[model samples]
Target chain A: MKRNSRLSLALHTLSHMADDPDRVRTSADIADHAGTNPVVVRRVLGRLREAGLLTSEKGHSGGWKLARKPERITLADVYLALDESLVATANEDSDPVCSVEYALHRRVSGVLREIEQSLVKRLGETTISEIR
Target chain B: MKRNSRLSLALHTLSHMADDPDRVRTSADIADHAGTNPVVVRRVLGRLREAGLLTSEKGHSGGWKLARKPERITLADVYLALDESLVATANEDSDPVCSVEYALHRRVSGVLREIEQSLVKRLGETTISEIR
Candidate 1:
């Protein structure tokens, strides 16, 4: 499967915030470090905020910061918030009704679910603090 | 990161071959099962043949079959042949040279490599024979 960039950006940004959990990182600053548009950075951070992974402020001096200790956050949390898939699966339209196709999809789906669980379990074991 | 569908199709095809291990499945058959274009199925199958995952034959009875025993094949091998990424990483254009961005990329790259290793290791442990 193709690698998606958004998830990477989110994790990288979270790691930075984890490094200095006490300080607020303006979206501009994060955008500068991420080398992406400030709007993009804000959009990702906004999701994190919505998920309670981080908190943000809108004022001049305000920005974003980890909502909780880095030790409490996991990569899985970030990934889930981003709604990324760990395993590749046939698209819905790839094959709709043949019994063989159905069987294959069922098997592949099972494998993906397993892999997703494994990935989440691994990510859950590592806190944002540990990455920093 | 969002999982791409192409890789899944490639792997699913290989798995089917590994199950039978000897039968030559036609492009039309595979496409019928995969619910995709015969051309798309052939294209993916072509790559597998190139990678020695399977061999294809032409003409009325010609189709595809695994190049090797399921026991000799690994999911990781199929995944690599499909050229799918296991971890999400920032896109090249996301940020081009900021120190923080670079550093983050480096770290994430390292992690991806590690995860890739772990994933392959696990996949390698299971052969197509075992899956079937």
Candidate 2:
């Protein structure tokens, strides 16, 4: 995602969470550290929770906690959990009327898919616990 | 770039250019085929020209022509020429006051850089000539 920092925020907050995996971090606290607002923190972290990478509670002391072991959570896991792509897929012309455009799209999409898979594989090599 | 289709546009145009490498295509024509405007085609092609991937002429009958052999123009050249990143770098908190934040930035930046470089390398492996 170009210039999008949600991944950065998610990773940074998760790195802190990895240090104390059991500790619950309020969205407000994460927002404070991330230099953002609680709503934004919740939005990003919410995606992680939905992906089963995290769990959140709603009480006043409610916050987010790791749903899995720090070592079990790879950067790829967080990246995938966010369910967004750093490399934008050229899905344009899903059905091109032109042959050249069609071929280019097909070939480029294949290459991009390969790169994406490789990227995920590389990311999977590093767990959140490895960050520290 | 997030959801940016400039790469797809450039590659598609160039792939067409490859078919008749010596033939010049007007910006208006490229735009029409790309389902965009001439200005957009000019802008994207301008970047490719700067990267020595393509060349343009002025006035009537003026248009874009491949500056190099299609084999010499790799997707990496086109991608880098855009000077935009598909993968968002975690350059936030460049000067983090917190150590965890600092380490996360450093480590994440490293991982992203690796992915970017690997992406470029993979892109370089495919030249415009090979696209067809």
Candidate 3:
């Protein structure tokens, strides 16, 4: 198993946006620079926009721009925007027939929650400006 | 996505073993304590056995026992024993049609590697005895 690539992509994009907060960069251009598909860039940007970290416009000369200052944003904000979970799992049945499975899940979930909170806390301490 | 329950199982089971050190535990018994399926515990044990963190026997009265002292083992050892990756991913094709996807994968992979290393470092600092 591997972590999602969206995490870094979101951070990288945010750094770019933060570098030039006043300029609006289209997804196409961002994708080109980032060496990815424009569609993928747009999808990521959409999530950031929804997170209120960025805003966008629809027109020939319109694209995406940061909604807030670079210092105000963190990696956690981007991760939340992408709706990425801190842990990974397969289809675990709602009713795990085995009690051991139940206990195992609970304990693991606790650790995962702790890890995630730690991750968020670390990310929270760093701003987009730092990455850029 | 959530992290693998096996990670916790490995750690928790190791902690228990460390506490007793002399008592051999059956999968069923361990599962009961941890609230999971015996099969799951056995499978996790199998991995631990392979990793040299544990060993098992297969007889009427046989079960599993730690291969090493609690002070000699860490959570990273358990995680490695379970072959669990620090990151999570869905089927990412070897050939990403999009360059951004490729770049994203590389960057994410880098960060994941760093995080995994960090986790291992932290886990290495603590032993099963500590957890117990």
Rate residue B89 of model 1 by lDDT: 50
| Whole-model lDDT, model 2 | 0.79
In candidate 3 the C-alpha lDDT for residue B118 amounts to 61
Encode model 1's per-residue lDDT on A41-114: one tens digit a residue. 88888888888998888777888889899889887788788776666443455435767667777777677666
iRMS of each prediction: 4.8, 4.0, 6.1
TM-score of each: 0.87, 0.88, 0.70
Off by over 4 Å in 1: A1-3, A88-96, B1-3, B88-101
Name the DockQ score for candidate 2: 0.39
Error of 2 at A13 (Å): 1.2
Q: After aligning candidate 2 to the native by TM-score, how far in Å is the CA of A17 from where it should be?
A: 1.4
Candidate whose TM-score is highest: 2
Q: Candidate 3, residues B39-78: lDDT per residue as tens digits?
A: 9888888988988988898999899998878889876687
Cα lDDT for residue B118, model 2? 76
Query: Number of clashes in every candidate structure?
Result: 3, 2, 21
- Per-candidate Cα RMSD to the true structure, in Å, reads 3.1, 2.8, 4.8
Task: Write candidate 3's Cα lDDT for A103-128 as tens digits.
Answer: 65555555546555665555566577
lDDT of 2 at B41: 90
